[model samples]
Target: RSYPTTTDEEDPDSNLNATCPEYFRWIHEDLRPWAYTGITLDMVERAKATANFRLVVLNGTAYLEQYQKAFQTRDVFTLWGILQLLRKYPGKLPDLDLMFDCVDWPVIKSIDYGGPNATTPPPLFRYCKDNETLDIVFPDWSFWGWPEIRVKSWVPLLNDLMEGNQRMGWDEREPHAYWKGNPEVAETRQDLLKCNVSDQQDWGARVFAQDWKKESKAGYKTSNLADQCVHRFKIYVEGSAWSVSEKYILACDSVTLLVQPRYFDFFTRSLKPLQHYWPIKPNDKCRSIKHAVDWGNTHQQE
Candidate 1:
């Protein structure tokens, strides 16, 4: 398989077209070689290889044009782009494993990805018929149909447990951030919101996040800014996570938010949900995923 840099023309064999910093933080450093550092046409061509199996990290559809600031945002064409590669190259791999955290159907439709009737793809299910294995992983948009996509969605409180552990370490009672991803975000935020630290001296002591990667292209323009923010004051995460797989990186980085019963599950071995971010309620069942507030109720339990 050929791995081309930026020089190669756009094709299925290419990868690393765009990346976010969190992409690197979650996995072990040793797997770096497995990643295609940049997007190139040759990389897509490489995907055509008839291997026993092919693991597609992202949708391989080719972009008609170049994407800028790929690190901080999402471009709809990504998933279809990868699928285009698979169809064009026809990998020797018998079965392909595709992973998605949420059911982003709009993106799928944007790529013209479904239906045996459509001109582009012959319905992902039909395309996989020839292959030995066809694996698809994502939260089932609905609880009905497609067994692989089925998931038992739950809100877990784990980060709080980890912070408690950290506290114990200081007291010579528990492990020191033994839960390396132990959180400070929830604990800190709740403290300020509840205590209403009316102290004017501590006003700027709280921040959201730094825009170090705001406009940069390289490695999502990584900076110590986020970490720097954590060091300076209490931080708040303003949005909901894009994917389930992405939580590990956010939790691993800092303990910016304060804690709660819901966020407490963040330490669960089975769930280990993301750290206390914007909203405090994890167990608060959402009326709809889309309508779900990022997070609310900064007041902590006494």
Candidate 2:
């Protein structure tokens, strides 16, 4: 969806302000505390003038005209993704230059341990309010707000499964824990795969290796979200730093066996242990996961 060129007075129900009115209001009101503090009307105006693009801010709403021209060829996906997010809430999204960065292994490989950009940026958005110079303050795509293509497709199905799981009582699900994702990105995931039930130690976790390329070839219809929620417990192990799958895992009614994460997203820190999810040790992942699964299965009433 594209932003309207007409003024707010010219068209009260502009294309950007029409759909998701409540969502827009929530963004304007709720997200005000988290908005970039450095961005002023003068800065916005100067950015618009210098870039030779029209960015209209009317009634706390920002309308970027020729937004595509400001971005480079490499940033197309990031720009499109951010625009899709803005389109979701319309005029409610704040007027700021949202920076994007990859948080996976590729980004990690580029950084030197004791180098300049190493300790500070961390290849992901920093959550602190004091860091005003850093315009990269928005939450990752993993959280609820952003509208990426993969997220847009899977979230609905996941929500449906969540609703279905709620209807089908917790006791009905299988006694074992479940987790499925690609293990190539992080050694933590590889370690998780190794924790699967074997003669050495019974982890009581049904772990599956996800082949994205193979799944894409098969049209991704084989991996049903509802089928995944059939277990009494769900394990959440991060891929690289943070995985979008965390939210999906927590959405299920089953007990969430969360492995200690290296990085925390916008909302992850807010989640309480033994309440929202059962936390497992990062050091002894195999043993911790096995213990958590066993305890949860034994205390089904809890």
Candidate 3:
């Protein structure tokens, strides 16, 4: 929330020298081109301080200290991703200042269904929870779509799969509603599994329960992202809070049968109902899913 301005007396060249424009461009050029504005040595320091505070408060001082050490060594996954991008771009990295006036860090107010207290304080930045408050909004990190941080385990794989699906085209895909993920994360996932009986018995959806522990033992090769896209419909159910799988599900050419989500990610508000996805009511999940699957199956060409 603090917006401090750089003093005019400060040497512009010194500020420029302190910034790694190559690093900035590498991390943000493709995802956020506008991030290159107003970036300075001072801004970077401020952002770092804010980020460190957030980490310390939320993830404990040890985590914050670890990140600080990583930043110092330039050996963190986020920094590594930036370095890779810089290497990929080589001389093409831009010299623009992309740091923003305000930091857009994400904060979660509450994950439960009852909703957050009305008297809750303003979020430090964008907030995520079951419902949106004044300063609380933006979906969870699963849908944040920032690949540089390596925050979530599935992100890098999901990113590659989405890109691969884009290249493969939609004509080759089938018409079944497909969903694959661990069902143990939430009761909603268990409800989703209930709808996956027989085509005649329930929703004609194909739901596969993914045991991550077993999958990890098998090196995760069994779960193919491109293969999941073969279906024309994909179901997105929230696990505990808001599911990160929502982004991946929507990224596919397949229409997403989104179960009424309790939480929203940073980009969820931008998506319109019946436009980007078909909403399935949580109370009538089975019936709603069946209806959506039937509708999507009938209107495949649309």
Q: Which candidate ranks first by TM-score, i.e. highest?
A: 2
Question: What TM-score would you give candidate 1 relative to the actual structure?
Answer: 0.26
Of 2 and 3, the candidate ahead on lDDT is 2
Model 2: per-residue Cα lDDT over 1-302, one tens digit each = 45633333543445864566322342343234335443444544433322323434454344545533422232333344455555555566554542233323123222333364543222222221121222223344333333322343345766777676876778888888889999998998898888788887787888989987887777677565666678888999888666767877888788899998765554565678999898988788777887887787788777
Which one wins by lDDT: 1 or 3? Answer: 3
| Model 1 CA RMSD to the hidden true structure, in angstroms | 17.1
Give the per-residue lDDT digits (tens) of candidate 1, residues 42-151.
Answer: 53333233221223433332223322222211222234334434555543223434322221211212234236564331112111110121212222221121212222
Q: Give the whole-model CA lDDT for all candidates, comma-separated.
A: 0.27, 0.59, 0.54
Candidate 3 per-residue lDDT over residues 187-290, each given as its tens digit: 98998888877746957778999887787677667665655677777899887666656767886768888887766645675577889898889888778877
Candidate 1 ranges beyond 4 A from true positions: 2-93, 97-205, 209-222, 225-270, 273-279, 282-302
